[model samples]
Target: MEKALVYINYPELIPLNDKSTEYDGYITIDDKFTYRIKLQVPNFPDVKNITYSGGRFHYIAIQEEDKLFKLAYYDIPKISSELLKEYASLNELFTTYCNCIEELQTYFDVMDSIDTVCWVIDPPKPKKSDYMRRIMIGHNVSIQITFDPLNILNLPQIQFMGSENGVAPFRESFINNLDNWDPEYDVVQNILRLIDLPFFPQEPTDAAKSNDLDFKVNECCICFCVQLENKLPDEICKNPNCEQCFHTDCLYQWLSAVGTSRQNFNLIQGECPNCKTCISCRIPNI
Candidate 1:
């Protein structure tokens, strides 16, 4: 009869079984923020018996949950001391839980905005408390942004990745437009404004895929392979007419076998395999 009354008053919470010891529901605050929650209440009146089984807890970092739980269970002295009559009601406990979750509104807001706009490359999926993300911004280009969880509306620390030539323009634009960043906008919006892009690049289309397959410019002339040991043929012959490509290791080994090859510090001065033109290979650091 008591469990039936509690369900009638708090329709948001649904019991898992006839015993009504477990519940699955959501807590909505001010009709704006809602978080899914699961609760196990073996001893209803004893707050300690109420165990949080799942929901937004998974969205947040494990380390930060302790503080939230403490806030929910112990922040109110009367509730913790068992002196308040309202503590006997599950509604009162859920209200306190909702208040604690409200404090994390900014974190949830920022994460939702990021998910809507960015293609997160690293950590593929992010927690509500994850402050860093690497997102694809352009073709073969990405930018790593470390957000300030407290000041999410402000500019984040950003590092651009890809070839030097590819990322230089974006880097330059970001530096020049730093003052133009508007804190009123979301993180992704501010970043797009700074880089002057309408939106982040999506995955390549079928036409782009076909174009990429049309060339084997990255293939190694020595090993006759496109990639070996996860490395492309990065070493190229200086001769414009005989611009053959070789992996750094392959070139170094070939040059070392020739008696004419001379080692000067970390450089191997050698002849091109095709043109016999003077070329050099920088001995890659092991």
Candidate 2:
């Protein structure tokens, strides 16, 4: 199964590929407040911001051999899937794999990973602003990555906006192109190491602190108290079995932050934290 994501053009996410600061074929660069917009997304569809998906909310069902992946938000208590007829397309599989997102959220809850709320953005593939790297490392929490702004359109509030203002009023209103996900050379380095991805092998000059495993993690292991440097998580471990922790501020300190990609980000052989013993865990905030 290919571990990938989906990107869609929803009512909230308009086709403002124009006026791009960065040029990539078919990928209109919308970096506008990608930072702030990314943050607001998890909060819900704001009249002032674009809509987004957050939390460890996902559901899956198989019909006629085709797997149907659904997005379920405890926040909205909404269960959604776009007639996901089958689960073969990498896009579908990945999106449906997001069905496991609920499982991921469950995993985080039991394991005490990520403490903060996470905005699950599902994109078909990596984009200029896409940072699976951070979500991979940041501890205890829900994670669903998608670019299908349509997911937001289904949000109760977004639906309201669409009916009242014809949807165009709120399209990408909060996410300016400048906010697109761009990691500096150094920031990428830290994110790669934090995820413990094999994509990049270069270690940090001072790798010891970033690898610290002594602090008392009364909170979620995936949780990072401080705000992310590039809105990417370096603190906490993404894998269930790994006891290692990293820093969010030092994303640029590790190695080449680019090109270190993997199919499955499992580091502990499908075991939970307390690697010494397999402990079934789930996140608390979800």
Candidate 3:
């Protein structure tokens, strides 16, 4: 029955063996790209029995593949355990898979373009799912930009990281020139125009100086480590006099244990560990 359905609906897919449980084919998207895929259906017409036997889709390796898979599983429709599913369900699965591939392609293309114009400080080698990047914009200054993978041409969310005095002018320039951003320009060009900078600062060539800068920029106050769980310290104390930095997870854990800390919706209000000034740490939804 499955063999018949494949022949009727997907003539391009060819059976791998006599059992007809496995098939391999090239799935074309928008008449522009063809992806070689292998699908396995152990039980005919059972949506739960299908699996992706291919190693990596388009050689794109995302750090959040497990999260993406869970989302897809819950979002995709499922049939009752006792009933056989229609071919439409299988079609939906293929459609969702193709959409993911297309999104990843766009994400990598943008990342490659950004790499040429800026030195990415965090996540030195970005994965397909790592949409947020920290790049050097000036001496002792950096900016974190988060891109929407699906909307590659849109203006990204930006946050400046460094001394308040050092980033103030850049922040003001960015706000004043927000309307000047053009989708026709690439990501690097738009950022340059927004900050009114001719070019991003080049990375330091002196090994000793670069190491010293990295230590000061990435160390967490609580953990006293440069990296924890493949992430640098991103949370900062808001108090101008006590601008201590910490990992978000580390701060959350510390705040949860503190007697004076209070939870307010998604934010944990507490005193800074260094200077004891009032501060808040945003709880990550993930």
Tens digits of per-residue lDDT for model 3 on 149-235?
767789999999765666789999999999998988877889999998998766666676556554235578899986887787777
Q: After superposing candidate 1 on the true structure, give the runs of residues whose Cα lies further than 4 Å from its correct spot.
A: 1-14, 19-21, 25-36, 40-100, 204-286
What number of backbone clashes does candidate 1 have, counting pairs of residues 3 or more apart or in separate chains?
A: 0
Which residues of candidate 3, in runs, are more than 4 Å off?
A: 1-33, 37-96, 99-107, 121-125, 138-141, 202-216, 238-242, 255-270, 283-286
Residue pairs that clash (backbone atoms under 3 angstroms), model 3: none
Model 2 lDDT per residue over 38-145, tens place: 111222211112112233222222222223332222221123444333434323433433443332333333222211222221222333223221232222221222
User: How many residue pairs clash per model?
Assistant: 0, 52, 0
Candidate achieving the largest lDDT: 3
Clashes of 2: 52
Instruction: List where candidate 2 sits over 4 angstroms from the true fold.
Output: 1-12, 16-94, 113-286
* Candidates 1 and 2 compared by TM-score, better number: 1
Q: What are the per-model C-alpha RMSD values against the true structure?
A: 11.5, 22.2, 7.4
| Residue pairs with backbone overlap in model 1 | none
Number of the top TM-score candidate: 3
Candidate 1, residues 252-276: lDDT per residue as tens digits? Answer: 8889999999999999998888789
